[model samples]
Target: MSGPNGSETMPLFEAVHDQIASDEDVAALDDWLRDNPDGQRQYLEFVDMQHEIERQIAGVFSRGPDSRTENATSKAAADGFLFPIHSVRWKVFAIAASLLAAVGIGWWGNSRLDDKPIAAIDLDASPVSRVLGIVTASENGLAYSGRRKLESGSALRSGRVDLQSGSMKIRMESGVELFLAGPSQIEMNDPLQVQLVSGTVTAEVPDSVIGFAVKVPGLNVVDLGTSFGVSLPANGQAKVHVFDGVVDAEVERSQQRVRLKDRQTVLFDGTSVAESSYDQDLFVQPGMNRDAIPTTTGDVRFLHTPPTSVRVGQFEHDLVLCFKERTESTLLETDLPVSLDAPGHYRVKPRWQNFGAVPRGTLVDSYFIHLDAIGPEKRTREGSITFNRPILGVVFSSSLLKGQNEIFGDPRTAYVTDRTNPKSDPTLENETITLSADRRTIRFSWRIRSRSDQVRVFVAADR
Candidate 1:
């Protein structure tokens, strides 16, 4: 294992092993071989043998998880001593012979190279159509229907909006207001996705809808759980505000996920999502025709103002919706049922439930939603609703309402079959227990076919 240059070839194997173990780039080997032509040939030969050993090891590891490649390498080194004709010196032969003499002569297996298949993250919202060249001061626009892709340079004014799938603020525009409802996807596809992108967008998302995803470069906002809005700086680079429900802010690069509650906002710049502990001023109010009573939760309140119908955008999974009116000029607020749950249990089944990790179990109930804005002229609403526990996925009895008096509740006994997907079968085994009368409440009861512990539920909403 010694080279003609007086350099040792066995040391080369150790170096390569270290690099591969550290996950370092393989290109570094070229730099090491630049000076020694003889060393380069030996390195190539060594690599060929190593690759073959790795291939064999991979098969063993795939079949038996306990097997490893290091044992194979040690075995190959031990076997090298038998050919003293290839040795560069007596010292080389002695070292090789010593390694071969060691006990446990059985060659060790190789590590597994099998890669797990990853599923695509479903982004249901559509792209923006005609986007503003630049939003400055106070300018407003509307998104009618379809998808709207965004450019990094688009700016949003306080009162301006690009309803359907536009960037910027989610709350009401400075003084100008826009609304997004139904179903759609809005994104801020900027490298620095930060700017004065501020505005108010009232979103009315119901469970019956589907496909509402908003992204601010580093953040992934998924809805279909409930309604909410996201406010950002007019500049693409800025913070995020959640007016209602919970917004699961996911960082793509790191795969980190965080949940934001109603009136809670977080800031992200590709690296992390930071939640604000301070109580920010409540923006927007309900219309006069409706009785708006703000929850006791800090500055967030609701007052009905003069009746005004805000426009909304449309999307593939559009559903019936009602908006919160500013009746008495109180703090702007939206209503969420107590028993609402997030879309986690049904969206992606647990890996353990996929047969590889755990046995198959019958699905009690499952459904997904898609919500988008009605038009460019409407305000933008983004965010979600999550339950404390996973439930037999929600079965909406009726669409959402604009006022408390019009709230939809299932106090009386009833059973509504899920029309969204035919696969879901609802039964008492997956019974859903709801708590309504103001505050958000979520609860579910189920009997396991076998022993099981806890389940995770996720909620995502935006306005």
Candidate 2:
């Protein structure tokens, strides 16, 4: 559900909305919480407020099966901020109600600090700023001169501070972090800054606009609020990655700027700007954007081919596919691998798209294939290609059900070809698929080796 306005994943606002709707009050409470702090501070406070609100509701009820015996006991618990409802069964129901009631309510009224419209930048502050602590506004200028070691939880605000030299842990105040190597200057305006100095830095901003900015000697690295690493090249060059969100890059010397998204990066070669790629560590978990996933029927076609080719000898010629998008967004990536019959001479011409059938946004998926057949001639070759598109009506279904004996413990049942059951209708499209005590239709796209055109395959499942 959307938050106060139409935010799909603003948990705090959703929670407050739900609470207000159910209780018929708390508009004042919600407004107070939101207007009191910045988005960063409000989010933190919301977490605490949610917990306390839960406690307060619990105190109104009697203790479990002892409702007849705990009138006084319950009243005492209500006196304090903590509710003492002791009825096990009632407590569960109360907790569930409380959670449901505040599903998407945040106290957003102002446009400056908290609950600012989604996908917006705080132009007042440094578009991206990182200060150690204590920003002293000097008569001459703003001096961020404190030499503080910004550890994991360390934070400070000032006009401008250059990270002269040192390994400091910097947080973006929104769960994002910036790791400065050394010898770098970080200037903080309200929402923008410059790496005017030099040095290497690594930053992780799962959400957009929650990390550091770059000010190359001849260029600028405006973060799209993603996780990535930046280094100064031999000349006055710089390299960056969009580990999660999009990062904007502008070539000061050339007056060029570009946005880099997850798994994407760009390089400034002292004279021009170029996009590049690198290997991501598997141990790191990326931050997520609640509203970024596409929820429509679409296609993901490769406007450009993947730079890295699949190694023919290491994996099976079959390529498995997967994707990363919001859960509410319907995704239909075939778990089955695409057959790559020819290796050395074979060119990948795969396409994924969102056909504008349902929602809109890019559907990002991973294609991984495992080859179990390898002969002297190499029975199977496997590799991967990544691509995205922001359209609709294209979904990938998993092949896990293939060769499986049963779904939901019922004897393996094949759906009848006739349309007696909706599951049997291949033409029917559904956004949700589940093999439970129910049934559903599955969509598949397939083509014969020599078929002149692609055929759409449909299967119905009976639970």
- Predicted structure with the largest TM-score when compared to the true one: 2
TM-score of each: 0.25, 0.29
Scored by lDDT, the top model is 2
CA-only RMSD, every prediction: 22.0, 23.5
| Regions of model 1 farther than 4 Å from truth | 1-202, 277-288, 291-463
Clashes of each: 114, 70
Candidate 1: minimum summed lDDT over ten consecutive residues — where?
112-121
lDDT of 2 at 311: 23
Model 2: per-residue lDDT, tens digit, 1-463? 3233345335445555454333423453355456455543645665666554443322212113344536643664454313333334324433443444457433222211221111121111221232222211111121235654332212355433455443444433233345554555554332224353455656665332332465656766666556666766445567776656677777765677787777776777777777665635311232334232212111111111111211222221111211221123223343322221111222214332212222223232321111112233321212222222212122222222121112211121221122233232222112122111111211123221211111111111111
lDDT per model vs. reference: 0.31, 0.35
The local lDDT score (0 to 100) that residue 236 gets in candidate 1 is: 47
Worst 10 residues of 2 by lDDT: 298-307
